[model samples]
Target: MPRKFYDGPQRDKPRENCAIFGVACDDIGYSVSKLLYSGLIALQHRGQEATGISLLETGGNIYTYKRKGLVSKVLNNRVLSKLWGNVGIGHNRYATTGAKEYSSSYYLQPFHFKNNEIEFSLAFNGTIPNYAELMKKLEDMGRVFVTNTDTEVIAQLIASLSIGTEDWPEILRLTSKFLDGSYAIIILTSEGDIYAMRDPLGFKPLCIGELKTGKRNLYFVSSESCGIDAVDGKFLRDVKPGEIIHISHQKDIHSEMVLRTNKTAICQFEYIYFARPDSIIDGVSVVEARMRLGMYLAKKDPILKNSEITDNAIVVPVPDSGRSVAVGYAKEAKLPYIEGLMKNRYIWRTFIMPGQNRRKAAVKEKLNPIKSVIEGKDIILLDDSIVRGTTMRQIVQLLKERGGAKRVHLRISCPPIISPCYMGIDFPTKSELIAAKFYNKYGDSYIEEIRKHIGADSLLYQTKEDLSRAITKSENELCRACLTGIYPLKSVEKIREIEDSIAKSRT
Candidate 1:
């Protein structure tokens, strides 16, 4: 097994950065800044460290504004009123690379690139495992970069490809061939056009939509369908895995499927935890997928066969992310569903907190048991997945010690995560994952060991088959790399070798 190369405490669940959004209007009568703000707010759950936007004024230069704060705080009325444009792009970011503190604005997006050759604004989701190799290639060509981010490397690559042609789609097509990681990118060119493209593997989600207000038409590109709904736009469809979509004032929406592959590896975490329930990805509804995961859990649970446990038990979710799954479990098992936990609206998500102690302390501050509903009752607690097991252990203790529950049965919607992810999700190293640790030592007894470690009366996890059936995608069509130690990208495999060698050296 390999240890993490990065030095620091890590969060328990998978966290991804960057939600890209762009809007293009047919008329200048409307400013797109407010619409951009609304779209970002809808996708805010995807990122929380920073927010930014770049707007192209009609017959004027592009203006960029960004800072380290939430979308609501960073893009306030005082700031949005000054940013006037009919075409613009926005981004919400939680860093997986470069600086995590977000102290400098240059590290944020939409990365406004301005050089002697071209000018454009870029917003991006997903990670590039081969970015360092591409950066070295550009450095050899006499390109200088200010930030150590893949976003800068991508901008420089596009500039290099634009030396002979100004066709935005052609430039992006050439740029995509050089990239070897998962990404969904939207670019706003000075020509007042927005170009959106998904990677060949489709590791992230991107969609297009349109809206009509009076006689003007508006087109949007967003990381999720929820953003389009936030602006009252009707979702057209998801961008094809290797497609480049062009939205402009001069033409109907244009699309070019640049690269074709037989298999795609869409991240499975989108269905389990990442995306908003109201959003749909790749023709599958998020809420429906989660509910099906719960149904599967209910079908195979051996403990449910005992009438004594099922008789006095109530199904309870771990707040927002687990609510849909709890609903399905209750419906399938014929148990009463109860909102046994009350969440504090003001606290930040404990899942994203840095240290184990801080996250454990925040768990109590963030959620309190409704003692009246759960007292003297057997509780079936549901959550998305168990990562490091720190939070789950704390929550289980909280339920028994504070809520007076007779027994706590912990149920997880996804299978045990045994591997790290290189495709944007911030899963910890193999050594740090609780399931991975126990599996290495106990083999087939890992689940029982985990149940004992977390202080749960019993534990059950959704099988991989159930996960695939719930999402309605074949095993090859989804990225289960975190559940199984296989990577789809050659660059990520090489990265694994390097990290393994580093771990061996330290040992």
Candidate 2:
């Protein structure tokens, strides 16, 4: 047997769709392509499968190019050289329920749509759960479809309703009535106006910024604050959930009443795993949240509750996400914090690489044994969360073999993920879940079962209290359904009925 607990969570797990970045610089002039490029680079972590940029000249014409690949590989100096304009939007993508066709030239955003000569470029992030129903309804109204993306559906829906009232507010007003599910979107008009909106539920994140160039006070909107920082922009505030933000040189940028939804369902994973540590969403610091998780994990000291002398063990972070938590734990535990593994910056990622072989191979390419750093130490490896144990296994072996560590204890920064996340994460089915698998195989709620399965000396996971405290939001504010299996939205009665049919095929 291959003994495969040491696995990278397959990109095979389902995921949220694409990241969006848009910039409108009306003052100290710069090329649209350059601005979009910087914003996309900042957001590369949000997607790796494909990258694209769309440019809108001050005069109102637009040009765009996008394809499946990393941002740098797809758009180099030569490529950016050809892209010219004053305002633009860009996207880095990861396929979720749909395929990569979403990034195809036609599907690429900012999706340009026109009716009776009025034109606008729209770029959208997040998914529309009601797209299939909406698509059929739109198709009945003599609207033809091109690419399969909610963005196009939205564009057409706006066009159909905007036929009579072409002004921005009325167009957006009607849009609010037809949309369902999570969305953070940006729209650029031929007349040089830009609009950004987030869904009422706020299942995704969007932020605004001010840039200091060309005496031009450019406004920025993106899936994360990291993107804003990439272009040397000042982080303003998060685009509130349900708010519609409008930007332009001629008028003060502000959110309009055309789109506003009561209540919210912010994606819980943004704090647990997704958003970059440096970024802040909805007024919360992502890095601060993770560090709190570390401090919380240290208090449990579950295994040490029975034994003394735990002081000798080292606290090692799994690298990247785990680093902050490990630091927090080390301080709380009064233990030595060590960097036991070095990440191979060259490897983009393991899961996003495509095939099983390639995903597993990426583990090797992405990590290096810091033998001198961890050797002869009782190592404790901390990670944000353990989706699948692939890289975890190799990491343990490296510490034991190369670093000469006697014991490799593991610490998880987040609670075990046992259910599929429907909000934004691409968790796929329950079966692809290693924690779910272990829960079935060993019938133990204690995390020790996971340690045994992965051949680890021991494992410590952050408790629900720890995780909640780290996020620092009201329990009602986040979608903790994946962690707690309590779907905030109604049960997927429709999806379950269809999926149940598929499950029968396996049986």
Candidate 3:
């Protein structure tokens, strides 16, 4: 009913970019909208900027409801009542590209495109690094685009490819050959058919699940296993890399390996920061992986094991993202683990807040030191990763200057981020990364310099080998491109160019 698309200014943060959810049920009476709402709510952490859902009715009419906001705010009971169907697809979006204007609702997906011949709604998670080139090719073929976002480009491309064939899997396989980056996308057609597909390299996460109600069985495809858990569904395995899964109106499911590659590049950040702790990704529990990271960090750093340090220092997590690893570190180091900093539950993530000033203010507002716990004590601070270093520096200053911490030793769960990410997690340019900037400025003394900059007594980062071990995956199987500068895809030059353009535009 809300036809007006609103656009607002953009923010920079370590974003998962988006989350996609889809379900098809054999029972027409099943409330697919409610199930989609539950699944999207479970994945709310993946994206808070916007939410959308597309439903296909039995008579071949497609309905979509979407708006810019949190899922709870955007999709209410009244809205859900309007989105009726046995099959539906949903999306939670955090803008990875395009202008963040109020009118940008045009970009909010499950994007629907309709014509006399065919119609479908698409929701996608992940970035297409070669979007400009792909868009250019489509434009050359006389395709018109309304939104600047890559989702529209992808949707149009799929529509164009679907022209000659009803074999959607084959069309997707052909589409996969032209796409050069990460994506896990779900599509709902007017005929009540749903299709889910992942990129060839598997840079993003997607999983399948099943829920049984009476005589009807419902199938789900989501960005994480937690979505399935939210709906009380049985956990099924991940959608294989380069696989296309189809769910028909009859609730029959089929999967095809449309693309194949020997190497898979699951984004490691999904374990370290992006995913819910309760979620299992790529056969690894995110919570356990974080704990292993702490154990590995403790084994690598003798200071954590030093009795003197452990006796006087209290292990404190940076709150939320750092909690799991801090607990792990405390156990391995034989130190006291305490909530030395209390997070203000009301505030949003500082990194996602728009502008440097707002981000700084949000960090101060979001975290407050427990003076009685931290005062006159040595503090071992555990955090997931250091991006811009602004928030970390602020926290160090808060603990020392305000809370009277004698010393602050910082430990990160992942290796230093030296390269930009193109697959969707938003650390787009080396220039915007504190580690890369410090490395460029201080050369071999970068680590010490960053420690000095953050006012930490000492700083230690996990090694790449240790990170791989922590996730229980080989280095080649993960996308550590941001840490090691070796991208899984061969579009490094193109990604850099795009990132540079983005950086300049931000300025």
Best by TM-score: 1
Native-referenced Cα lDDT, model 1:
0.89
Give one digit per residue, the lDDT tens place, for model 1 in 1-507.
001123345567777667999999988768999999999999999888789999999785788999988999999999999899999999998765444433578888999999898999999888888888999999999999877778888999999999989988889999999988889999999988899999998999999999987789999999999999999999999998989999996674789655888999999999999999999999999999999999999999887999999988999999987999999999999999998989998986666667778787899998899999988889999999998898889998889999989999999999999988888876677898999999989999999999999999999999999999999999989999999989999999999999899989999
Please provide, for model 2 over 1-507, each residue's C-alpha lDDT reduced to its tens digit, 9 standing for 90 to 100. 000111234553334556898877765256767778888988887877778877776566877688778899989999999887777788877654344444356755557786665787788877665676788999999989887667788888878877766578667767866776667888877777778888777889999887766566678888999998998889999988878888775564677753544556787678767788899988889988877888888888765553443645778887676798888888888788877778877665455675656755676677766777666667777887776665576667667876787787788877778777655456646676678778867777637777876668888877777677788876666666667766655434455567669988889
lDDT of each: 0.89, 0.73, 0.84
Candidate 2 backbone overlaps, count: 12
Q: lDDT tens digits, residues 241-321, model 3?
A: 899998775847788665789889999999999999999998999999999999888888767557777778999999888
In model 1, state the lDDT of residue 334: 90
Worst 10 residues of 1 by lDDT: 1-10
Clashing pairs in 3: 6-102, 6-103, 7-101, 7-102, 7-103, 8-100, 8-101, 8-102
TM-score of each: 0.96, 0.89, 0.93
lDDT score for residue 201 of model 1: 86
